[model samples]
Target: MAATPHPAHRFLTMKAAGVTLAALVIILFAGLRFVHLEADFPPGVSGSGDLYTDEGAYSSAAVRWVTTGQWRLEGDFNPAVNLPVYPLIQAVTFKALGLSLGHARLTSVILYLLLMAAVWALARRWAGPVTALIALLVMAVNFNAFAFSRLALLEVPMTLFVVLGLLAAARGGATGTVLAAAAFLLALLTKTAAGFALPVILLVLLWRPEPLTRRLAQAGLFCALTGLGLLAYYFVLVRGHLPDYQTYFMTNVLLRTQGGLWDLGRALVRIIWYGRQFDPVLYPLALLGAAGVLVVGGKLRRHPLFWISVVWIAAYLATLATQNYAPARFYLVLAAPVGLLLGLMIEHLARSGRRGAAGLLAGVVILALAVSGGRAVDYLRHPQYSWASMMRELHGLVRQDGRENPVILGHFANSLSLGTGLLSLNDHYTWKSSLPARLERYRPDYYVTLGGIEAPIRSVLERYGTVEPVRTWDVFHNYYTGEPVALYRLTRKSPLEASRP
Candidate 1:
């Protein structure tokens, strides 16, 4: 016969066990991040390719800061692409620890660790310690989150700040409104996605009519402070080199809303479908969870936080749906709310004695973990996996050429350009407006072009120099070949005497 333990003893032991499990999961996640820290220039495959163009731009800006003590946001004389906050953060990292890819990636690792803490806090508030542990584990093994966190990108910081904002807002205490406002401002400055969260927060405050006036006042003060900070930072520190707000706002914000209803519908459908790419096994369960949230209408409607999260997810999805180009990555903000709903469903099922459903849910999560974890491990072990290899090869070529003053001209070439530390002329996919003159001015020692754009590059190079085959690299797997697809590079040299000098 087994001895029965006291209720208090069992409770204490379970709590200790949960803490230990959470610690182990966090440690494992950190270990995975550190293990792949220096295997490549940008730390991960997606981080080294076109997927991380923004990261590459920031990296180049950081490099300039390190070498010249200048923090100019303009890249290749294109001021429109500048986003100063992230680049400034990267510059500080580079300054603190010399200009190395690993150092740049470390900034992301730090942010990811902080994000885990934020997620843990949020989950604990809503679902207790066990579910929080599960949520952290899910985040740790989530392929998209893991991949992005290891890159020098703005998304991780933005996600972290957003989680902070949500955690602060959900506190349900006297300081909750103030803390939430501060966190929201931080998130807004980090990324434009933060703006979409405003409606949800406001709606939640309205639902909670008791603290309506107080919360609104706090939110107003926070927004004002944030605006003042932005104005001061731009006019005073940046010396009035404020970006073309109208153009950026119109193009990236207002004009982007021109997409038709059908276009938005298609994008939403694709987003919902593709969001489950990494975890197909859990797809049905996630849908069920979403349905469950709707089914528990009365309970959810009364809960301000629950409605806030739902509204945030819906508004974000709508915003993404309206975008001209929709990628699975755009729905990342949807993950947090999805996770919350999934956690709620799991708890509901567990409480209802539907142990089989809970087991099934756990199995799906485990399957997702296995598949994503395997992919991550493979990526870590094989840095030369597709686009990553091409970028690495290009970087090596530039380093070997011993040409510190080299310039490159191409379309969609920011990643390779920045990785190789070469001056980029332009990233336009189409040839236009004095292309020859632009090439001559940059006076590039090498002009590289990807395969798809080879014809245009050949025509452009004919006027300046001869095109030569430098190297080839594979891009994701191809269906026919049953292997990764290959991209060819064509390089050219300057023809003019002034360019040669």
Candidate 2:
């Protein structure tokens, strides 16, 4: 019989193995993330209508901040509708380097990788190296995470900060509390949704088995300092520049919660279901992991961090589910914890003499990574991937038509058109109603249309001038589909202006 390996040697071997596995996962994730860093915006921004609006607004703000030192919300840049942290960061980045949409998006990608590292570290602490590696692998290729990571939006940063906050809280160090507090404040500034799970974190700290008085006092001080700092920052620097923050808070937060508890339950279900968009393969494993948590809830009850994760996931799902609309992106916060739970399940299986479990987990992760990677590649190569490019081409058409300044009128198209530096005659006006009158009033030098023509666009274009055929662009979601996207220039004879001419 072979001599039994020493326990020390066995531990060393396992550690080495874990390191190797984690490195491999990181390499795989990086290749996928950076594959087309300079390409257009990610998939959702292309074909999906509403998704691009936010990205367009944020990118415009970034450009404004870089070109002019003003951070105030411009007509095209809707600060009132969005949280400031991510855009603020983008502005800072733009200030540091010239504005590059690709560079700005690359910043988000880097944050996502940092977030992955954090997840791996946190999971490693709770589970083991193998479980941590597996968890990172699962999150690396999760479609929603991958997609958002590539976009220049607040969601990815907010998700990163939330994960950082949770990781710090789990470590239970004094410095960790400070890190957690800072991250929490940043998340709140990034998105209103940050507030939903915050209370649960406070509750966890208050109820932890540690000295209740000390923990409560620490928590209170953290909140107080954070609140005071934010107050000072806003009042001194960003107060008047921001729209009525209180009004926004009331509408987005308080009023949003007026629905009954049953609404909350339904919302929770929807959030749970939305995870299917990320990866169908991992959903069953995640469910099994959630069941494991439920089965071991009694043991986990003593673990404050565990309860915090549970509460955070629960509260987030509940709040988002109750909302009138549930998008797949809203479920991003669930990715880390769900990945952790799945990692724990895999670990349990591996320990139970099920060697095949590890192989199966690896196989699923590899397959998902390949699928997500392929999707990312397709998005980059497709022309419609870049909203910036579409806007640029549209601007060129207007310029070529000798329309020095055109009154741009449209909805979703306006976002890209205005965002990429096109001049709009009136910010408040869109060609949604009475297009002919509005077109006559504004006397747009050109009319731009996108996402197929509606009556308003067609009527205005026909009334004003000839619609010149532009170019076609491809749009992307999970995959690429070519669509005829045209930018038409409508020219009209100026009455008084031409008389003067």
Candidate 3:
């Protein structure tokens, strides 16, 4: 009924609207994270998947710090396990929001939203609004990233610092490089495993278009800052406890698994198999984006972001291949680069300026995003925190012995002890040499095991053999491996002799 507007006016209006939507997308996603911050453990059913063990361990440690003013896992000061940054964050959140893990989990949501914002900002600079939106959607909608990002764990927070460091590196100046170096240090301090990322980060200067002397100067200062920071952190400040951190680091994170080339192949295959199970589109698209980066960039040195994407993926896969225990969570950090690659590819495709082709690509991307959003919605509707019935049964059994509290031993000894008001020993952290002696001394009446080497405990308690409890918890700790919970009752042979059987 009205006169048509000019084509240029319409195009400009549409462009402005698109940019507004892109900006709002990330902010809306961040708001969504705060929703259902307290949702979990719908009664009488299984969880979406395995609970990363560190989630509870860190939360429990924070709870201990808040309640008793001790930042410890059980009674030990295992520095590798107690990397000060994330647990400190958890402690701060718990102090503000009260002692429940629900409050602690809010920290992850907040950090993850911040992570998305950082990713969006970086991607927008490298590509444009369309690419940035794609990056945001892929990161938020992908199953693995969505799942772990919401939980209270080191992975998301560590990943955030790593990306922040990269974003700083992209700023392209001496001062920016220094800030980037410092951010990488923060990432390392957050999680020692972040050490694997150092070499790739160090190569940031190679991406710069500076003169040889200038780039060299920047790289030298960058390396000096990062290296000195690590030395100061490990040797200077916590010098007295270096041995404890070293032992835990070597035993648990570094040498926890050993394998050769074939193992590496298997690790890659395992990663692909399980990674697709979470979101079929994300991994495949990321691989395509990586290839697109190389082909389009022509020379590696010219495209800093593109080169960085390739190096990041290659380095991460190499690190994963080296580890025999290929937990899916180990693959989580790749999400950052994957999002970048996706953004780059989407930007590249759009540059073709073919509306039909762009429409096709957009359709495919939208479909993939829709699928992930549906899965996320389904998960939120039935959030899986912990087994509710298992707690009731365990509590009932614990109360059966009216006279005294029964000693409990398990991999989750800290949480179990906190929940049951009993002395508990964490089987995973106890040194093998002292294990038998501790078992002999503690003589725990019941062993509440959550998947550890039970042979030693069984050998030690041969005289008082274990009777399997009524309930066996059906749960997965990692990648379809059913590390079920078992609460076995051990009674001394002399004490319960039933009719000379």
Candidate 4:
């Protein structure tokens, strides 16, 4: 049996609890960040030295922007690959903190912190203080958020803007509407994929308590203006850049969404499994809450917060399934909604006076925090910093070959280019059939292959030079693989012999 407290005292206690939860979130994320600051990669790649692929491209772009005062891709002005918001943020960080991987990643860390703060605000708005606290706790320790926050990538920032817009929409006023419009525009500038959120936002506005016709008209005007502004901005920026606006829009948007049906199915499965992986107890509870609204659409169905989460999950899933590729970080958009749903579900259960069920939920939360926190601690402090040595050796080998600014080609060309200060080309994507011709055209001095070379690619290289080991690599520290990395220099062959292949 529990004792009921005086109303005044209970209010004070709740306020104290909220403050404590806020502090805990700050300490947890900030501490986790610094604890794993040297997690696996070296300083130049990511602050925590993780082998996140996009970090290299984004950071390299930032370095170029900061030093040369031009936003370029692969040493040329190309706006096709990424939007300007993230690179612009990184460039500002470079100016203030000096150009280093740690400083570049610091920008992401800060954005993630802001993201957590936004989650707390949105959760508090939908649910009470207790759910808000739990939501913050879950986000603070969840491995994906912890890990991705330390990398210089755009996912966290994109999610941040999206959540901010959602929060503004939830507030429901003239000011909130204007803020939502601005936030959504910023979200699009961060990542064009954010356009997927438009459907969700439209759904939200329709569900608003205001009269249907007025709300729809207002939402329509606002969205139209926002889209026009974004187009005008992009039009101004694409001037004199390679892969201009039309080409970028067609390839990244139109072409990218055409296939990958299998990928969509797989992503749906992975999102469910990984959602559980993040928090076994809470995610299932979230699903239960979702089902509750579907089955018992009383007030919950009409609630603005409920519909917001519903739309977010549906829109993001559809977007993920339709996209050509799905990375783990792309699933991050689901985290906040899951948190809110969990809180709502738990609140619903508690209100039904199922004390036993509520007790079990508490147990699950405790178990999840302890289990997830323990795993994160082990991964962070582990002494698998050997990847730094491997990259250093590879950099040395490139320098030893007496080829400054040499054209180098590999699968992870962006990471290698960033690490080695040499021209690196990625063969992972795009016209594989033309790889040989491109190699001849680029005329790379060194070819790097992870694990070993395949026959087709090897045959092309063998036409020009024989394979020789640069150095034997024992392990790759990032993915924790023991595969040996091989580097080969394409010694010149006679023009006739080279043409024989």
Query: Per-prediction TM-score, please?
Result: 0.79, 0.77, 0.81, 0.81
In candidate 3, stretches whose alpha carbon ends up further than 4 angstroms from where it belongs are: 5-25, 38-52, 58-60, 73-82, 172-175, 236-239, 257-278, 296-302, 384-408, 415-424, 439-446, 450-455, 461-484, 488-501
When summed lDDT is taken over every stretch of 10 residues in candidate 3, the lowest stretch is 41-50
lDDT by candidate, in order shown = 0.59, 0.61, 0.64, 0.65
Cα lDDT tens digits for candidate 2, 322-405: 565556666666777667666665666666657587658766766776786577556656635455666666666666766544
lDDT of 1 at 54: 52
Candidate 4 off by > 4 Å? 1-26, 41-52, 66-70, 73-82, 171-178, 207-209, 237-277, 297-302, 348-356, 418-421, 433-443, 459-467, 474-482, 490-501
Better of 2 and 4 by lDDT: 4
Q: What is the C-alpha RMSD of each candidate to the true structure, in Å?
A: 5.0, 5.3, 4.8, 5.0
Over 1-501, each residue of candidate 4 has an lDDT whose tens digit, in order, gives 888889879867965885686567547655677554534532221222135346655455666555556455332223324477787787788788776555766788888878988988877765677666666666776665566667677788888998888777766666767778888888888887787778766665666778877787758865876777777775676555535455446544667663556766776676556555445666677777688778987655665566677778777766665655555566566777776665565555566667478557756765776676676677776645444455677778777778645776666555554444455555543335656666666677777765678787887777756666666565444242335666777665778766683
Poorest stretch of ten by lDDT in candidate 2 = 423-432
Q: Which pairs of residues clash in candidate 1, taking residues 3 or more apart in a chain or in different chains?
A: none
Better of 1 and 3 by lDDT: 3
- How well is each residue in 1-501 modelled by candidate 1, as lDDT tens digits? 989999879967965985696568657866798776645432323312345345555455566666656544242433223355566677788778876666777898898788878877777765656566666666676676667667676667777777776766655344766666666666666667667777765564345445677766655655565577656656754455434344344544676673678877888876666656434655446666666767766443344445655677677766666665544445455556655555555655666678688768866776776687777777777764445566677777766777656666564344454344455555442225447676655656555444444466557666566655566554543322333322333344534532663
Error of 2 at 68 (Å): 4.0
Model 4: worst 10 consecutive residues (lDDT sum)? 41-50
RMSD of 1: 5.0
